[model samples]
Target: MALRSVKFMTRPFQHNSNRSIEIFLGTMNEGNYLNVGLGGSTQTIHPDDAKRLRDELIKLYPLALAPAAAPASKFKAGDKVTYKAIVGYGARGMDGRKGVIKDVLANEWYMVNFTGGPFDNLIKVHSDYLAAQPVEPRGFKVGDKVRRTTGQSKGVVMTVVETHPTQARGDIRVDGMTGWRMQKYFELVTDDPVEAVKAAIPTVNSGRYLVVALEGANYVPGSKPKVHVTDIGANAEAERLAKEVGGTFHVFKATFEASREKPVIPPVKTTKL
Candidate 1:
C-alpha cells in the first residue's frame, strides 16, 4: 500500500479592518492563508512563523470544535444553607439568614430563598457568604417560649420542642411553624428581643469598560459598543481590539478630582494690589 497525506492550500489574504492581527507559526506567504493588511488589501505573513502557526492550529482546532461541557455548581437546588445579606432587622443587621437553594446560577452565585415572612427578597449571594447551620447554645430547654434576638427571624417567637439541654444545645420550633431553630439565637419571650430596624442595601459592580470603533471606521448606525466588566478585563480587551479592529477603548473611571492645581509658593506679594 502507498502512503497518502492530506493538505489545505491557503490562499493569500489581506486584513481589511484597522485592527492588528496576530500572526502565528506555519503562516504562508500566499494561498488561502491568514494574513494582515490595511484598507481591505491583502498582506503576507511573517515567513519565519508560518510552520508553527500551522502546527498549533492543527492541535487547537479540535478543542474549538469539541462540544462544551456544562459548568458545575458547589450546591444544588433544595439544599438548606445560610447566606449573608446587607439587610436584616436586628442589632447586627448584616447577619446570616437561613435559606433554601432555589437554583444554581451557572458557575456563579446561588439563588436562595430566605424562607420566611420578613425576608421577601430573593438572595443571590456568592459562596463566600454561605455557612453551615449553627447549633444552639447551652441552657435552652423544652416548653420555653423564646423569640429570636438576631438574624432574619428576629422577634419571631418560637417555642422549644424536645429539650436536649446536655452535651448538645437544645432546639426550638418556631411558633405556628414546624422548622426548628437553634436556642442560641433566642431568649425568653418575656425578655423581648427588641431589634433596631435597618434598610436593605444593594451591591454594585466595578471593572466595566467600553470599546468603540475609531471615528472614521464604517459601522452600522446605532450599533452597541462592547462592554467588559471583569477586573482588568475591559482594558485588555480594549487594547487588543484597538490593535486589530482599529477602535478606541474607553475605561470607565469610577471617581474624578476637580480641584485646581496648587500654586508654587512665591515670597508673598506683601506690596498690596
Candidate 2:
C-alpha cells in the first residue's frame, strides 16, 4: 500500500484569462471535498469531480495566479442558490448558474448541487459567488432526504413533508403547511481512514523513580501512573492514590534515564543454575 499524502489539484488552467483554478484534497468533513480556488475566489467541490477534472485539465497551460480569499455564509442548507464564475476558457465559458445548497463545508464554501440538466456544471461555490433567493417550502418526492431549517427541528433528522403523487413542484406558495420546510442542506457522506498516533512518555533523571498506582497487589489491572520523582513524596502520593482507588502502590528506581528504567524487584541469589 502507498502512503497517503495531502493531494492538491489545479483545475485545468487557462492562462488566456486572468483566472486560475487550484484545489486541495481534505476530509476535514465526513465527506471528502476539494478546497477549490477560482483565481482569488475559493470554494470546495467533491473529490471525485476534482480527480476527473484534473486528468482532463493537465494538458492545459499553467496559470501562475495567487488565490484570493472569501468568507462563507450563515446560509442554511436547502436554500435556492445562484452564482457566477469566469470558468476560464472552457466549453461552458464564463456564466452564472442556479442550484440548491448541498452541505456546509469548511472554510465557508458550500457544496452546491446542479445535479440535473443544463445547470449541472457547478459543484461548489463561495458565498461571494452566490446570489440570494427567498426561502419557501417546495414539493419533493417521497423517500427524498430533507433538512429542517427552523424551530426545534433544526439540524435534526426531520420528518419530511407528506406530498401527493400529483403535487406540482416549484416555488409556488402553499397554505396550511403547519410543519413543513423547504429543502437544500447537503446530507451525503463519504468515509476515509483515520491515522492513529501514539502518545510520547516523558523521561526522568537517574536519581528519580517512576511511581504508579496498582489496582491490585500483583498488578492485575494497573490503576494509574503517578509522577516519576526522586523524592519520597512521590511514593507517599502514590500510596494515598492507591488506597483511595482500592489499589496497591508500586515504584521503580530511575535509571540513567527514567525512560530506560525498570522496577527494582530483587531476588536472593542463594543458588545458581
Candidate 3:
C-alpha cells in the first residue's frame, strides 16, 4: 500500500469594508477539502470538484493585497512634550510638567528641557518617558521583557502584561506581580538572558580591565549589586576572589584623560559564561 500525504494551501479574500475571509485548501488520499474561516466561524467541506469552486471564490472577492506603510516617529526635535513624574525614575519631582525636546538621541532616547524641573538644562530620557499629552509612562507594552529600576524588584527580569483594561492610566501590568505599575519603573532588557549575562561578564585577556568581586552570587541577577573598581588589571585574581567569597566578579576596561573619563572597552567574546 502507498502512504497517504496531505498538501495544504491558503488564500485570503476580502468580504466587506471591515471583514476578510481566509480559506485553507488541502488534498488528502486523492480527495479535495477546504476549510473556510471568517471572524470566529470556521467551516470545512469535502467537495468532489474543489478546484473550480476555489477559482470562483477568488474571482468573487477581488484580491485587495497591497504593501503596508512603514511606521514613523511621533515626536521630533523641538517638539513640546509632557508626562507625569514616575516617582523614582527620571523626571522625578516634576509631576505633570511640560518640556521641549532639546535634542533627539540615538536608540529612542531624547534630551528634554522641562519647565521648573530638577535640572536647569536638558536631560537625557527614553521616548516612553515623554508624550504629547499629560499621561503616565507609555514606554512599555504587552510582551516586553523588562527589568525594574527600583525597590526590591530592581534588576529582576519580568514581562509586561495587560491584565486590566485601564492600562493607560499608568497601570502597566507585568507577570508575577499585582497592582498597577508604571512604565517608567522598568526598562527593556536584551531578549536573550544568557547573551546578556555573557556580555556583562568581561573577558580576562581583554586588557586593562577593572576587576571587583561582587557581594552576591551570579552578579547580574542580584539586587543592586555594587562593586567599585578595586584593581585595574586583567588577572586571575578576579576568579580566585569569586571562588573564595562564593560570589562573582566583573571586569570593566576604563579609559581616562586627565580627570575626565572616556569611552571604555567593549565586551569581547569569551568561552566562559
Candidate 4:
C-alpha cells in the first residue's frame, strides 16, 4: 500500500466584485493530481459533492468572518469582536486575534479588532470580524438615551429604521450634534442592558507604562520633576508637568522597550565649577 494524501482542486467562481464561490474536488490522488496539473490543472469533481462543499463552506466562511453573527442582535458600539484573519491557504498570518468595533462603516465595514503594542496596536476590521451573537431587546425606544462608546459624544436615539433580516440602524442625536450626518450607526443591541453595557466598552491596551528618570543640575528628588515624554501617547499632560517643574523634556521615538531584564540609565551630566 502506498501512502495517500488528499489533494484539492479548486474552481473559482466570481460572484460580483465583492464575493466569490469556489468549487473544489472532494479528493484526488497523487497520480490524478499530477496528470490534472499538467493539462492546465483544471479538474472536475462530482457535482453533488462540489455543491455540498460549496454550500457548507459558504456558511462556515461567514461564521469565521463574523462569529458574533450567531447573536448579532447583541452587538453594540463597544462590544469586543473576535476576528480571525482569513489568510489564503498556506499563507503566514495572524489568526484568532480580537478587536472592538469602534464604529460601523459603509458596506458592512465595522471598525473592529486591533492588535499591536501599547501605542501601536491599532487593528480595524469589517463586519467580517463579527458573527451573529444572541441578543434580547432592551426597553430602549426612539428618543431614549444612549452614549457613544468611543468618540466625543453622548446622546439620545433620534429615530430607529428597521432593515431586512432583523437588522436596524439608529440615528443618535449627540450632544451639540456636531456630526449628525455620521451619527447614524448600527449595533447589535439586545434587551439586556448589562450585556449591552459590557459590549460597549472599547478594548484596552493592558501593557505596562514606561517610566524614565532624569538626573541633572536642576533635578530634585520627587519634587514634581519635569521630564520630556515621547512615543505615541506622550501628550499634553506630560508636557505640562515638564514645564511646571522647569526640567528638560526629551522624547524618544520608540514606543516600547524590553522588559525589566535590563536596566536603562540616562547619561550623567557634569558641570565644572
How high is the lDDT of residue 87 in model 3?
A: 56
Per-residue accuracy of model 3 over 1-273 as CA lDDT, tens digit each = 343434333343455555444434333443545554444466666665456666797899878889787455667888888765565775446666788988877677888887765556567878777777545444666888888878998778898886356654455788878977877778777758897887467544333455655555543523543334444343455676677866667765556646657889999978976
Q: Residue 31 deviation, candidate 4, in Å?
A: 69
Where does model 1 exceed 4 Å of error? 1-71, 85-94, 117-119, 134-273
**Candidate 3 lDDT:** 0.65
Off by over 4 Å in 2: 1-72, 86-94, 115-122, 136-273
Candidate that scores best on lDDT = 3
lDDT of each: 0.59, 0.54, 0.65, 0.46
Q: Worst 10-residue stretch by lDDT in candidate 2?
A: 194-203
lDDT of 1 by residue, 1-273 (tens): 232222343444565344444332233324434454333454555534546666787888744566777777767888777765444433244356687788888656888777554645576777767665655444656777776778777667777776544434555555555566666778765443342222112223475455544466653322675666753676676688778877564555434557888989978556766
Compare candidates 1 and 2 on TM-score and give the better one.
Answer: 1
lDDT of 2 by residue, 133-193 (tens): 6565444545444434456654444333465444343221123235333344322111323
What's the distance in Å from true for residue 195, model 2?
59
